[model samples]
Target: MYIDSHVHTSFSGDSDTPPEKQIEQAISLGMPVLYITDHQDFDCPPGVPEFTFETEPYFRKLRELKEQFRDRIELRIGVELGLQTNIPTDLTAYASGHPFDFIIGSTHVCCGMDPYYPEFYENRPEEEAYRSYFEYELENIKAYDCFDVAGHLDYVVRYGPNKNTFYSYEKYKELFDEILKTLIAKGKGIECNTAGFKAGLNHPHPTEEILKRYRELGGEILTLGSDAHQTVHLAYHFSAIGDLLKSCGFRYYTVFKDRKPEFLPL
Candidate 1:
C-alpha cells in the first residue's frame, strides 16, 4: 500500500484543516496508510510563532478518529519536532511515554532565528546562511538523538533568494556527508519531502542529488511525505516520486509503527 509518512492536521499550529478532512482526502486518493505528524517546536526562535499542542488531547482526538475510520484507512499519529539547542528532558519523557508512531527531527530555527524570514538572510550571504543552518542541524541531531528521521536535509536552501539556483549536493558535500553519516550511525532515517515541487523549486526538499548520496552512503529507512498542511496536498507528486526514487537506486521505502521501521518494496 502507498503510504504518506509525513503529514499534518489542524492540530499543528500552522494548519487549519480538520483532521478528518485529511483522512477523507487520503482515502479518496486510495492511500491505505498515512501518518499525521503535527508540529511541536518546544522552544521556537524569537519572533517566530510557538508550535505547541497538548499531547493527551491530540492523541485523544486521534484515537477517536482511528476508530471512526478503522475500515477506511489506517491512520497513525506522529510529531515533527523542531530540534533546537536546548531540548527539554520532559519533552523526551512525554514522547517516551506517549504512543507516537514516528517522530521527525528538523532544523527549522538556526542560530536562534528562522530562515523563513527576510531578516534571517540580512547581511549574510546564502552560503553562510546555508552553512550555519547545516551546522545547527548537525549539532541539534547530535545532541537531541531522540527522533526517528531527519526531516529535510537541504530545507535551508528552499528559502534563499536564489532558492537552489546555486545549490547542489556537491557544494555542501562535506557537511552533507557528515550529516548523513551521523544519521546512519545513530540508526535514524530521512524523508523525501515533496513540498518543494509545489513551491516551484522543481525538486524535492532535499533534492535528488542528496537522496542519491544518501543511498551511496548506505542510508536506508527512507519514507515519503508531502509535508501537506491540507487535504489538497495529501499525496502530492507521488506518481513522479516513484520514478525518482528508482532512478536514485532505492528498491524500497519505509513506514513506522510504534516507533519501529517497516520496509515496503518499491
Candidate 2:
C-alpha cells in the first residue's frame, strides 16, 4: 500500500480520532509508514475554525508513540502547515523550530476567507473564486520557502458549486502551468490526495491531467496521501493509486523522513 502522508488525529481542530487509533489502523493495513500530519494553520480569519495545536503536548505524545511502536511501524511526525500570503515568518519559524519528518504546505485560507465556507463563493462566479485561490497559492509559495510539498493543489475545486463537473486543466492552463513551473524551480513536490474520491469527485485532489503536466515539467517529488481524518479513511482509495501513478508517468512515489525525500518504486 502507498504510504499515507497526510493524516489527522485528535490534535487537529476538525478531527477527534485519537492518534493511537490511526497508528493501529495503519499497522493493521500493513502500511510501512504512517505520517501524522495534523492541521496547524495560524492566524485564521474571523468565522473560520481555529486550526492550531499545542506543539509541546503534540510532540510529546507522538514521540512516545513513535518509540512504543518502533518495531511494528515507522510512524513519522508531520504537520500540515496552512500557507498564507501574510504569515511567511510564522510558517518559517514554526518549520525551523520543529523536527518534523514531513511538512505539507497547504493553502486552506484564500483572500481572507476559506473556500470551505459558503461565503467565499457567495458573490463571485465559481471560476473567479478558483482563480483567486490559485493567485493566493502562487503568492504564498513565491513568498515563502519553508515547506517540502504542496498539498491539495486544487483543494478549492472540491467545494465549488459545480465540483469539477465542468473543470479541466485547459480551462486555466496558464495559471496551472505557472504553478507547476514555480514548484519545479523551487525543488518542491506535490501530492496526489485521494480525498477527492471521498468528496464525490471522480479523481484525486489534482486531476490526472495536472499530475501529467507536473511530470512533464520535470517535477519528480510526488507523494500520495489520503488526507484522512478518521480511522476508516486512512489510506482511503490507495488500492488504485499505483496504476494511476503509472499512467501519470510516475515510476516511483515519495516518502519523507527527517525532511528528506526517498523515492520508492511504484
Model 2 Cα lDDT, one tens digit per residue, 1-266 = 77999999999999999999999999999998899999999988988888999999999999999999999998999999999976534788889999999999999998898899888899889899999998888888887788999999999999999989888889989988999999999999999999999999989989999999999999999999999999999999999989998999999999999999999999
**Which pairs, if any, clash in model 1?**
none
Q: Name the 10 consecutive residues with the lowest summed lDDT in model 1.
A: 86-95
The clash tally of candidate 2 reads 0
* Alpha-carbon lDDT of model 2: 0.93
What TM-score would you give candidate 1 relative to the actual structure?
0.97
Best of the candidates, TM-score: 2
TM-scores of the models, in the order given = 0.97, 0.98
Each prediction's RMSD to truth: 1.2, 0.9
Root-mean-square deviation of Cα positions for candidate 2 versus the true structure, in angstroms: 0.9
Clashes of each: 0, 0
Worst 10 residues of 2 by lDDT: 85-94
Residue 59 accuracy (lDDT) in model 1: 93
